[model samples]
Target: MTMYWRAISEDQPGPKWAGLFAEYWPAYLKWWLKEGDEVRASYRESQRMLKRHMPEMLPLYDQLCELAGGGDQAARFLSFYCPPPYLSGCSQALWPGKAPVLVRNYDYNPAAFDSLILRTGWMGRKVMGTSDGLWGLVDGMNDAGLAISLTFGGRRVVGEGFGVPLILRYVLQTCTTTEEAGQVLSRVPTHMSYNVTVVDRNRKYLTAMMAPDRATLITHAAVATNHQENVEWISHARFTATVERERYLLHRMSLHRDTEEKFISNFLKPPLYSTAFSYGFGTLYTAIYRPRKKQMEIRWPGTTWPLSLDSFEEGARQVNLPGAA
Candidate 1:
């Protein structure tokens, strides 16, 4: 299958964003209403949650909601409050090299994934990364020298909280350092289990094990794969190879003492590089973030698409991944 990926830059929410929302809203609405709209949060509760937790993003939220056509279902979905449960496979690590670099592979089913990279200057802050839910980020960096990414926590419990992607979006929008990101991650309620890893330009990094039912665990771990401190979901851990991936990353952190280039190359092959699209865990793209320089790049096996906070260009590519079809 060939996925048509796009990179778009919008200094503020406007026509470009509206067009995207228009194009994506139908499918999103179907997914949001999949379990029935009655099961999702009401528009009132969704708005209230947004105002209470991420007040700073309310303005941008309103803009995106309006662009999504001012419908109740659209508004609620954009809020990302108590939405349906979702999961993905991913691996993230902070390089122990001289310069601070955060790299990860976003493992997900391409059919359900948003093949869009968005660069935005909303609320006077420059932020960009792989966009999900139209307004949320799967992984992204800011001009503040903070970068972040996520992986599934390999658990099945779901609770009442914002989706993890929106939490990631909020961190990039409001926080400037690893400390601030940690605070947000620790506080925000998530409906499912997620392992969020963040790194700053100072080379300081931390991973937050966040779930809806328990207090978030803040750790100094440099590597994060699909499970948390323990393998709570044994079958998931085995299928995704979460333990093996974590060990591989940890092993590289100690033994692969070489150029950052070589370190990144490891992610392009197994067992880190996954081709399990048939199982909804294929490695869609690998992201490399240099918070110190405010730059990011997306990598496939033999392709590279680079962008920066300072200068971003709009373009598209056709990506063919095995088993995605």
Candidate 2:
């Protein structure tokens, strides 16, 4: 399967951030409704569900509704189609408790990558109301050498709250450490289930935060596949169980002991459930952010496309001060 990959590093802060819904609401609504009025009705139901669950995010809700040209269209779409227990899949990993990573292979469609990216960036700018750009990060590494990755927990039951995608964006924009990130997660209620794996530069420490209805933090040598072990509670078993399967694969690949390159080689394979999940265009992408080295590498495993920070102004233009790493 083909994939689109990008890695960016900035010495100084970039432009103001934007909201993701600004660009996505219209296109997404139109696309989902193309099937007919029944589909449209279902979409409306979803939006209503979202509003009821996340009343605190009313400002964002209002912005999205306005962007979609008002009425309950945006609210309905979100309630019925977007939240957890409804939209059943995603995956992620984190590095050093700071760098956050994520991979989402939707059951919806495989060809939606290009449109998703364009619309995400557009909506990010518009909805976030930032001058910068729209981006729901697949993965992000922080200045502290803390990295994070995400994966969807395909469970039958999930707490009704804000979507994990938005939570992730909020974490990347605001938090700097595992503790800080965890606090953010604990405070915000999530609509769906997900596993967040965190890693540090030393690679000596790794943790996974599992959110079933609430958040639970766990300590392990490494976490693979779908299940996330946290302190407070263990999430119910997932229907897909990809994480369990991936755990075996990771063991065979020696991922816990291997170098980053080797680990990534086995980690980003095509999805096993091809019928339910598509593996084209956006299924797999990898990013390596080494804060200690003060550099980052973004790779498209399927396409073999690799890009380094040296190529961009955010990386090249800035002088690497001594001890910056």
Candidate 3:
């Protein structure tokens, strides 16, 4: 399947963001309400949760709701509070070189993705990343020279908390350093298990294993795959090869003296790269972020599309991938 990907710049949440919401809402609504209306949180509860946990994002949440026409379902969905269960495969690690760069491969079904790069200046803070659920980010970097990425922790337990993408959005919106990012990640609860990694301009980083049933585990490990401290779900671990991917990354970062180019190239191939689209683990894209330079790039095997806060041109590209449809 060929995906039409676009790079969009909306300094604020207005017409452009609204248009994209309208285009994607129908499909999102279906997914959000997949279990049923009663299973999801109410608009009131979602808003209250957002205000309590991420008060800084309340104003932006209100603005996005207004842009979404202020419907109950849309507002609740925007809040990203305990909604539903979802999962994906991903791997993230920091480059060993002096210059700090965080690289990751987002493995998931392409049909479920927004497939766009969003550059937004919400609340006067410049932020951009691969957008999910319109405003949430699967991975993104802010003007503060901090970048973050997420991988689904292999588990079946679900509890009360926000979906992780919004947590990432909040981190990029409010935090400037890895320390602050770690704090936010540790405090905020997630509905499911997720290993969230953050890297700042100084390259100071941490991986927070966040979940709803327990306290967040903040580890100094620079590399994270699908599972957390342990593979709680044996079947999921085997299916996604979370252990193998983690070993590959650890060995590569320590054993091989790969240059930056070679290190990133490794993620596009086997072990780290995935093609299990039928099982929702296909490698959608490899994202590389240089927080110090304020630059980001979306890379395929042979093609590279570069973007930045300084020169973020608005355009679209067609990418052909396997099993996306």
TM-score of each: 0.98, 0.57, 0.98
Q: Write the per-residue lDDT of candidate 2 for residues 1-325, one digit (tens) a residue.
A: 3332222332322221123455445665665466654634454455564455444444554554555455565555544334323333333333213333222233223334321211122212211100111234434444455555556554445555555655555554555566666666666656566665555455533444545555555555344444554222234233344555565554544535544455455435544222333322123234444544434444333333222322332211111111111
> What does each candidate score in C-alpha RMSD?
0.9, 9.7, 1.0
Error of 1 at 230 (Å): 0.3
Clashing pairs in 3: none
Candidate with more favorable, higher lDDT: 1 or 2: 1
Instruction: Please give the ranking of all candidate structures by lDDT, highest first, separated by commas.
Output: 3, 1, 2
State how far residue 198 of model 2 sits from its true place (Å).
Answer: 2.6
Q: Candidate 1: where is the Cα deviation over 4 Å?
A: none
The global C-alpha lDDT for each of the candidates, from Candidate 1 onward, is 0.92, 0.42, 0.92
Tens digit of per-residue lDDT, candidate 3, span 204-252: 9999999889999999999999999988899889999999999999999
Task: For candidate 1, list the clashing residue pairs, or say none.
Answer: none
**Alpha-carbon deviation at 300 in model 3, angstroms:** 1.1
**Backbone clashes (count) for model 3:** 0
